[model samples]
Target: MGNEETPESRERTDRTGWRGLLVDVTPLRTSPSFAKLWTGTSVAQIGAQITIVAVGLHVYDLTGSTLAVAFVALWALGPMILAGFVGGALADMFDRRTVALVTATVAWLSIGTMTLIAFLNVTQTWPYYVLAAINAASATILGATRGAILPRLLPTQLLPAAAALSGITMGLAITVGPAVAGVLVATVGFPWTYLLDAVLFAGAFLGILSLPPMTPEGGSASPGFSSVVESMRFLRNAPNVRATFIFDLIAMIFGTPRVVFPAAGALILGGGPVTVGVLTASFAAGALLSSLVSGPLGRVRRQGRAVTLAIAVFGLFTALFGVVLLVTGMMVGSAGPEGVNVPAVVLAGIALAGTGAADNVSAVFRTTILQAAAPDDVRGRMQGLFYVVVAGGPRIGDLLAGAVATAIALWAPALIGGLIIVALMLVLLRIARGFQHYDAFMPTP
Candidate 1:
C-alpha cells in the first residue's frame, strides 16, 4: 500500500475483526466539528442531569409523594411536545448553529434562575414548575437542532457509530450526574447543586458557537402550522420511521420505572438520595458498558430486527427489576435509609442496568434508521418528532408509574408495564414485518 491510504479502504480496515467489536471512533477522528459538539454537549448533559435529579428529589422531599414527583414531568410535557415541532421547523428554516445557540442560551438562563431561587430560599414549588417547563421546552428544541446537524458533520455510513457513541455520552451524563447530585444534595444543599449546573451549561455554549453555519439542504420550509402538517403527512407514508416511534413509545411508556425510584430508595431499598442516585446511575452504567463494546453493531444488516430484539430484552429486564423490588419489600417492609438492603439494591441495580443497555441498543438502531431513511429536507422535522418520543415518552411513563404505584403497589407498575411491553412487541413483530426485516444497506422509512 502507498503511504497515503484511501478513505474507503481505511473504513473497511476499521470495521474488520477485533475493531468491529468496539465503538468506532472514526467519526470523531474524521470530523473535528463533531468531536467538539459531542464533547461540549456531553459535559452539559451531566449538568442537566444534576438539575433533573435534584428537582425530582426536592419535590419528593417536600411533598413525600411519587405522584408529586411525577407532576414535574407533567408540568413540562405540553411545552416540550410543542417545542419538538417548532424547534424542528426552526432547524430546517434557519442556520442550525444559530438555532442551537439560541435554545441553549434559553436553557442556561432557566438553570441560572433556578440557582437564584434556591439561593433566595424561595420554597415556593410553583416557580420550580414554571422554570422546569421553560427549560424542558428549550432543551427539546436544542436537541432537535443538534440531532439534525449530525448528518451534516459525518458521512452516512458513520451515523450508526455516531449513535452508539451517543450512548456513551448519555451513559456518562446520567451515570455521573445523578451519583454526584445525590451526594451534593445530601451534604451541600440544593443551592450549590443548582449553581454547579449553571456553570456546566456554559460548556454547551462553546460547542454550539464553534459549529459552522448549517442551513437545511435540498430545500427549506417556513416554521409554521403548514410545515408541521407536511411532516405528519410524510410520516403517514413512512412506515419504517413510524414503526420506530411506535416501538420506542411502547418501551419508554411502559418499561421505564424511574418515577418510583425516589420512593423505592426512601421506603423500600433504604439508601435515600444516595440510593436514588446509585439506582439511577446503574441504568446509565449499563448503557455506557454496552456502548463501549458495540463494535459489531455497525456491521449489522437487519437493524430493525436488532431494534426489536433489544427492546424485548429491555422489557424482560424491567420486569426483573420489579421482581427484585417485590422481594425486597416483602423481606424488609418499610425500611428507611438507615436500613440499606445491600443485596436487594445490588439485584435491582443489575436489572435496571440491563434495561438501560437494551434500551441503548434499540436507540442506536432506531436513530440510524431515522437519519438514513428520511429525506434531507425533512430530517429536522423527523428528528424533532424523534426527540418528542424519546423525551416525552418518559414523562408519560412517569405519570403512569406514579398513578399505578399509588393506586396499586410500588412494584405493580413495572411488573404490569413490562409484561405489556413484551406482549406489544410480539404483536408488532407480526404486523410490522417490514420493519422487522429493515435492511441497513437499503434503508426505507
Candidate 2:
C-alpha cells in the first residue's frame, strides 16, 4: 500500500511561505487524541487563570495589603514543589493517563470547595490559602503528567511545533482568564467568578477521560523516594537540560513581578482590577502573538542560543516595565482608580507585552530541549522537575517581590530582578558554552 498522508509527511513537503510563518496545526490535525487533550487543557487553564487573578483581587480587597496578596503564591510553594517531584515519579511508574485523571479530579474538587467558601462569604483568609495550596499541588501533578504524554502523541520533528502550540494554549488562557476575572469580580462578585472556574474545569475531565493508558516506555522504576532521587541524579548528568532549568529559575524568580500588580493598580497606575487585568492580558497577548509567528522557530538549529537570546530580551523588557512603573509611581502617589494615567499604563502594557513574547519564545525552546533530550522512562520525572521550576519559581518571585516592595518601593523588585537576570544569564553563557552551542539535529542532555 502507498504511504498515507501524515503530519511528518506534510512537514517534509512544506518549508516556505505563510504556512511556515504560522503555528503548525499539523499536531492537532494528526492526532485526534492530542486535539481533545489540547482543547480540554486550553479551557481548563483559562478557568484556572481566572481563579488565580480573582483570588489575588479578593485578598487585596479584604486586607488592602500587597504582601497578603503575594501570600497566595507563597502558601502554595512548598506543597507545589513536593507535588512536582512526587507527581513526576507517579507519572513514570503508573499509567500517565491515570495520574493525570486523578490530579485533575483533585484540582476540580478544590475549585469546587473554593467556590463554596466564597459563596458563604468567608472572610477568613486561611481557608482560601489552604484550598489554593491544594489546587496548586494538584495542578502541578496534572501538568507534569501532561508534559510527559506529549512525545507519545507525535513524532520528534513535531515537538517544537507542539511546544509552540502549547504556548498559544497558555497565552490564550492567561489573556482571557485575567481579563474575564477582573470584569466578573467587579460585576458578579468573587463567588460567581470562582464558580465559573469550577464549571469550566470540567473540560479537563473530558480530555483526561478520553486519553488511553500511557505507561512509560522501556519500563520505569517503582514509585517512591528512590524514583525521585533517580530523576535528580539524571538531571545532574544532563548539562543542557540543567542549563534550561537554571535559566528558567533565574527568569521566573527574579523577573516575575506579578505580586506587585495589585498595589501598582491601587497606588501607582490606578484603574484598580481593570488595570491589573490589562497588565496581565498584555503579557499573554505578546505570548499569543509570538506563538502565531512561531513558524520559523521549528527551523532554527541553534535552539540553546535561541533560548538565551529570548531570555535576555525578556530581561530587557522586564527592566523597561519597571522603569514605566517607577515613572508612573512618581507621577501619582497613592492614586485611586479615578486617577489612572493612560499614557503610563499603555507604556507599561507595551513593555509587559514584550516580556511575554520573549518569555514565550524562551519557553518554546526550553520545553523542546527537555522533551526531546530526555529518555521516555525518565521524561515524566524531568517534566516534574521542569514544572517545579516553571510553577515554583513564580511563587518564590512572589515572596521576593512582596518582601522587596514592602522594604523599598513598588518598582524596586522588577527593576532589581531584571538587572540580575541579565547579568546572571551573561555569566551562564560563558560557563555553559557547551549548552550555548547545542544543536537541535543532535540533542544532548
Candidate 3:
C-alpha cells in the first residue's frame, strides 16, 4: 500500500496474533473529541477512585463500624439521584459541554474542600460526609451528561466499542486507584492522598472545557419539571429500556458487596489497607480483563440475552466469592493485626475479579442497547435514568450489604444477595420477553 494506513491495516498491526481480542480503540483513533474526552476522563477516574477509597478509609478510622461507612454513601444517594435527573434536563436544555463542565467544576471544588479538611486533620465526621455527598452528587450529574455526550461524538456502529473502551478506562482506574490510595494513605497519610486527588482533577476540567458545544438540533426545550416528566413518559412507553434499569438495579442492590470490603480487611482478611486495596483492585482487574478482550461484543445482536446471561454470571460469581470467604474463614480462622492469610485473599480476589468481568460484560451490552435505542432528542434524560440506575443502585446495595453483614456475618449478605439477584433476574428475563429477545442490529425501545 501507499504511505497511508487503512482500518484493516491498523487492525492487522495492532493485533498481530492473539492480542487482537483486547478492547478496540477505533473510536479513540477516529474521533479526536472522543479521544480527548476519554484520555482526560480516564486520568480523572483514577484520581476520583483515590479520593473515594481515601474517604472510606478515613470514615472507617473515625467510626469503626462498617454500617457507618455504608451510611456515608447512603447519605449521598438521594441528592445524587436528584442531581442525575436535573443534570439530564440541563444536558437536554443547554450546551452539553457547559453542563458537563459545570458539574466537573463542582466535583473538583468538593475534592479541594476535602483536601483542606484532611490537611487540617478534622476529627469531625459530619462535615466530611457532607463534602462526600456533594462530591458524589456532582459526579452523578457529570456521569449522566457525559454519557449523553458520547453518542453525539461517535458513530452508531462504534457504540459497542466505545462502551468497551470505557470499561477499560474504568477498569484501569479502579485497579490503580484503590491500590494507590491504600499505599499512599498508609504511607503518606490522608491529607496527601486527598491533595493528590485534587491535583489530578485538573485533567477532567481540561477535558470538558476542550469539548465542542453539543446542543440538539431545532433548539431543545428549557430545563424544568416538565422535562423530567417528559422523560418519565417516554420510559413508560419503552419496556426494554425499563427492563435494563430494573435488571441493573436488581443486580446492584442484591449482589453488591463493596460496603464490607474494609471490614473484611480489618476483621477477616487481615492485610489491612493493603488487603482493602487489593480486593478493590481485584474487582477492577476482572472488569479490565473482560473489556480487554471484548472484540466479539460488537457483533452480538441478541444484546438482551447477553445482558441477562452476563448478569447471571455476575451473581453466580458473587455468591462464589462469599463462599470463598466462608470456606477460608472456617478452615484457617481470621488473622490478627500482625497476621496474614494469603490463600484466602487470593481466592477472594479471584472471585471478585470474576464478579467485575461479568458485570462489565453486562454493562457493555446494556450501554450499547441504551445508546442505540434512545432517540437523540431525549438522550440526556435517558442517560440520566441510566446514571440513577448506575450510581444509585450501588448505594442501595451498600445499605443492604452493610445491614445484612451486621445482622448475620460479613459474608452472608453477598451470598444471600447474589442468590436473590440470580433468581430475580431469571424471573424477570422469563416474563419480560421484550427485554429477553432484544436484537441489537434491529433495535427497538
Residue-by-residue lDDT tens digits, candidate 2, 297-390: 8888888988988998899898998998888777665544467888888998999999999999999999988988888899999999998887
lDDT of 1 by residue, 1-445 (tens): 1113338426844576777788888778877788888989889999999999899988777778887887898898889989998999998888899999999999999999999988898877888889999999999999899888887787666778889999999889877887789889999999899999999998898788889988788889765799999899999999999989989999989987888998999888988877786788788899999999887888788999889889999999999999988888887765443678888899999998999899999999999999888877788899899888877888778889989999998998888899888888888778888999999878877
Question: What is the lDDT of every predicted structure here?
Answer: 0.87, 0.87, 0.83
Instruction: Please list all clashing residue pairs in model 2, or write none if there are none.
Output: none
The estimated TM-scores of all candidates read 0.89, 0.88, 0.87
> Which regions of candidate 3 are displaced past 4 Å?
1-19, 58-71, 116-127, 186-189, 260-274, 329-341, 403-410
Arranged by lDDT with the best first, the candidates are 2, 1, 3
- Against the true structure, whose lDDT is highest? 2
Better of 2 and 3 by TM-score: 2
What are the per-model C-alpha RMSD values against the true structure? 3.8, 3.5, 4.2
In TM-score terms, candidate 3 sits at 0.87
